[model samples]
Target: MLKPISTPTRELVNLDGVWRFAIDSRAGAEPWTGLLGTPLEAAVPASYNDLFVDPEIRDHVGWVYYQREVRVPRGWGGERVLLRFDAATHAAKVYVDDELAGEHVGGYLPFDVDITDRVAAGERFRLTVAVSGDLSNETIPPGKIEVGMNGKKKQTYFHDFYNYAGLARSVWLHSEPKTRIADVTVVTGFEGATGSVDWTVVTDGVDEARVRVSLSDAAGAPVATGQGASGSLTVPDVTLWQPGAAYLYELTVELLDEGDSVIDSYPVAVGVRTVEVRGHEFLINGEPFYFTGFGKHEDTAVRGKGHDDAYLVHDFQLMEWSGANSFRTSHYPYAEEVLDFADRHGIVVVDETAAVGLNMGVVGGMTGTPPFPTFSEQYAGAATQAAHAEHLRALITRDKNHASVVMWCIANEPASNEEGALEYFTPLVELARELDPTRPLTYAMVMFATFKNDRIIELFDVVSLNRYYGWYIATGDLATAETYLHGDIQGWIDRTGKPIMMTEYGADTQPGVHSVWDQAWTEEYQVDYLAMNHRVFDRFPQFIGEQVWNFADFATSNGIHRVEGNKKGVFTRDRKPKAAAWALRARWRGLEGRKPGSDGSTGAGSGEVTGADGADG
Candidate 1:
């Protein structure tokens, strides 16, 4: 869908703040007819799970209700009024007063509805959105609903992260003229400092409107202009967007009438760059690029998967301070605000779909000793595949314009070794490539999907592996872990001969816990674990990138396997640096062995690195 923006012919009003919220128990009908019963206030653009101290609210399964009041601006009488929900977890249904407006599935992506018919202009009416967290085999990121001992439904999934659901992003009231720009897609490239932008404009409701496109430099000076619905614009002496150094050009698309009067206008921030996989290197703008960062989650202290601008800025700042150049939105897509920041700051991103835990026997496989067939009729069958494809379509359409998004990860740790693995992923891979052919594609392969067992590794452009030798397998046996790691890498190299990247590899470490020897879950051990992995990575030319498992600790489902939450973060959930953070800073910044003082400050680095330069140190 076209993102709502304020233009001369369009208006956007942010409807984000406190709203009346209640947990749904299927107790009644016609919920849109009156005020919410026993409604408690909830902050929009945040997950409601951690906002309350009540355990029932935190663990409540199934659907929930969020109600707010909105007024159709009197001036919008002639325009199309729509309600845009940036995101609603899993599934949602919109009700304008007593009429159902629209319904949508998929949690991470945005959905909208035209409320024009339900509400009159200048009239104040109720806007209610019902959000559900329940999942089935037919949904993306599939899971099940189980009744607990208390006879209340609870969500069960294979992933480790908490299922913090609700309205986790901004909602907007927007309006546009009858004839407006519907969609805009742009592809950027550069050859010897001259950048080319191929642009397409899709218009709605207007058949005779003239199309005009223009490109402006960061200084707001016009550089190139064109007339047509689809064409290419070239800028001489153009600046390229690079890692740690971002440059943007504004692309403005406008619709005009026969009299040359402007009817609609929309601008997109364009970063002129190209991404490709060349042998053992990933290239951006014709230069060899390395991915060094983390697989991050949109999580915070109380937000719990919510998109917070403050945390967004801080997280990027911390990543920069640690010399990271890129990151993957690990298991799912993150907020668009985060991607916009990455484009502005020149941070590379490996954008992914919300297709986590699709595997049957390994990470999210059957609960029994034998894993159930993953691609069976009861699991991720045709319906699940369709959902997954639509998810990819929306993801690419929404994010394909960003320069920071260089690669698209189709899934994280799927059971690619299973029977239907190859058949299931073939079309999705084609769809991703067909939708956006400018960038490479990858999927984070679980450790179980080895070269011998994996059936779909050769289909992807790059080999992305999430190997946890020291943590899950060797467990403090680095000497033995090194052997296993080497074998795995060599096997992958011999199997594919394609460039490989480590999307995840880290040990859980508590901040204050220290150990001098090779141990797991200790600060010193975290440092050692990273060093060992890097040491092995440096020896292989096929290993082109290394994005650690996590940037910071995050909340997860309560279990004996976790203490408070996942401690694999180099930094704490509060953004405090652990010993591994310093080790990373040292190696990534070309300095190492710098110990922190008692005041939680980093000391001088040792200034010794072997894995080349720039993030690899």
Candidate 2:
């Protein structure tokens, strides 16, 4: 008889306390091994700035070593022990008991290393991890600065966010049975307005496992159930989930043996909706709904990249209040909690990969002396392209089952004209279709819309353009901006006859300031900009939806336009709503005949219609 699958309780071993930290300044130094009496005390999951205020500490860029001692539980014997890092910037090399455990790259995603073989049960062991953020490492993605040397063509990124390098997220010790469920992928489909759930389970075990998958409504009542072998199962007659009528169904999958003893269980909230690009217009369940949202960066002023559920929820409320129905995870994949909230709140998402091809010069046509040697073997060559492709693949595969995700964007502002860029992009688009055919494929095109490269647009199910109408080109020239935007988009529609979305459009507004030198900082200007866009939006039959340039104020190291940062969000950096919020809410609510306080009070639940947790007033 098999054990019934049970939900694994996450017991967090807080590694946030003080840990021994030191900077390794020597070039190519072996992993620090010398034992010292007492080291500089620094908190785990804290930045170097949190402990010291030296300008050198702030500007210093290199490897930082952290050491700590932990005792393995005696009861944890025979179980597979895993060390999970919520996040570590750049590169992390982990060692246990002087044995090299593993290394991981990429700062946003979660990674774990199995330490069962490296450490004995009930034994005290010293764990050392060295983290490096050397800007010269080609494997590490460029951030904040650009380096040009000897025509070896390596371009650093000039982004608008702080480079908080550390264990910026969480770390934990997870224990699981040697043979357990590995992963789960759940997908939902809506046919004729009815929904169905399909799930695939990956496991490692010799015994034949019984799998039970259950779908529940928001109130936690079982709506559908399916049972099968430890592989795949399909549940029919699921509740159709919509954007405003976001009726989410929680999915629980359990691995069990013939005896009904539980083994392991995993749960994820899922919504059921159909998204398609139909002849120039994107449709959601055959309804024409406009997208009004912003791009979001997963960073905070104080928290850095630490996962904060409350902050995420507050962001959702602010967006909904500002009349947004959709958003994009700009430049990278965001936290799972953000996506989960989107699923429940009915916010459409353009789940983008961590591939921001900002280095691609074709978008802005910024041509200069090439940075790298043209024909050199290491000329930002195929290996870099391949690494990027692999990263994109991992991102897509990791988040494929998310129902809120309406499109897969392979690269953001990539160098389209580069020799092998299209070569990399085309295969990724094909791979996205192969993995999940339900959603469309999209890439953000900037500036040039000539048909000379329409072939790239033809490969995608939907073609999107990120136009900076009045901001970058002409300020206060609303009529000209509209004419240009409408003409370019209509031309694309006439050429491809494919569905189109205005993936990005908005002006930067400095919150709390009403500037007479052009209302760039005033809420009035923000409202007028969106209102004018709505006029053009009403005329464009081919356009599906429009997501604004940003949702909230995010950290940007590169402060441009004398504005200190990208002050484009409808809300301030602290998630405070600007005066434009009310105007957007009125438009989104479509509340032509309704009066304020008609539903009773004026608080979270006082409005006639609630906006994602009844928080819009």
Candidate 3:
């Protein structure tokens, strides 16, 4: 399942415009035989939930059908044509010319079906896709869809985000040779002044084939070359991809015929570096790299969870402006373009899964409160674990080669203290390690999990904690919150001798509300909360990274707890800088020119932030 890298010989057609859309609310809709001509039109790579004004259409909790007509290029005959959908939420089924093509479970990953035979036989093809955003006890981000007192279905989950559904990414038709290179796995390291690249090329149609791997510098100069399906190459003078001074090498894999003529080639972008955890230190290229960034979500106005190029470029620029060197794909993996940008700009990413809000009934069992039914021990059985394992394989197979993805975060705030949590995560952790041992594995531990109850912490290479000492637990008391935060973090350090990363720590702040002093939901309060966390973070040498809860305000499900979505973002929803944004900019800027392995005594101080310029203030 190696991701396809575009080459000059490859043919690609993007299907990314308006398409006929309709909702199958009756749940009687079947692919390849049902309704044909729908009048309503929606963007192909957009969310159907947010496009409509009607409440029923906005909150429709059933199958969404998208139909379009595509003409396969006449030259694509004899070649393997792939009908690729970049992403479809929760579940998706594809049909071509009223024939079942493929069905895929789980979303946020790419899936494709071979249509070479059919495409060669037809001039025009009818393409249809049915997508479901439904979640249950059996799903990864487990939840329940129950009828409320008002006779309307309500979607309730442990996560604090909206369930946006549709073809959230791209759709395309790509042509490849019948016998081609299927995958390329790369592991890079340094040997003295030179760099080493060890790789394995997996091919289909033949057990053995002639493969040639060539390496080039950014300026298109040949550095090193090799000839084999699996071998190693040494570059004399390699440029290491460093923070602020990012560099990249171009890797080209060519598939040859028996006569040594090239049949197909894959152009890949790779960085020469290594990531490892040494004792309590997280190192990148043998340097103690401190991460200063946010736990970001792929969300914005109107688009909801849809991928947009404008927002994508804007976010990377803002991250650079804020002096951030890294960020985690908080709850799930983002679109492929986002990671490409991170690689180009030298931003480290802790790539995470969509496995958020997986807490079960165990937490409340100790107390008197009723536990969550969807995440109980009944749901964490063999079936659920198998589904999760498949998702991990798809994700790792898709993103294992990216230079920006420094670590792999298997889950976010899962119920590590639950009854079956250990049993469930044990195989998953082992599976991820078996898949890619080059990267470190971690899961964001919830505050509810203490030293005595939690067992999953010992399994991970790094310890990632999402603690809210002053916000959720201590209300608004930073004085008392400091003591609680210090003790909890120290206890974890004593328990596991691994590097600690604060994956989430922030206070929600409304846009306009201001207070001279610290008041809840005020701009000053967020600034104060961040300052306290920074002060405490400076005390520990084992603390390697500090990623805030959110990078910007995002849309979420309507609930009493959320005020116009999560306001924990340093920037507003429209990408405007709040007071806390300026505070962070100043703090991160001070650490800009410093070397990687430095002990910081430079604490952040108060600063005056300005108003929004071009956008509405």
Give per-model CA RMSD: 6.3, 8.3, 5.3
lDDT of each: 0.83, 0.63, 0.80
Model 1, poorest ten-residue lDDT window?
608-617
Q: 443-546 in candidate 3: lDDT tens per residue?
A: 88776666556768878999888877678767689987777777766777778878888898988899889988768899999999999888888777888888
User: Candidate 2 lDDT, tens digit per residue, 288-361?
Assistant: 55666777777666556556677878888787676677888876777666777777778888987755533433
In terms of TM-score, how similar is model 2 to the real structure? 0.83
Q: Which stretch of 10 consecutive residues in model 2 shows the poorest summed lDDT? A: 608-617
lDDT tens digits by residue: candidate 1, 443-496: 988766777778998789899888776777778998767777777777777778
TM-score for each prediction? 0.94, 0.83, 0.93
Q: What is the lDDT of candidate 3?
A: 0.80
Better of 2 and 3 by TM-score: 3
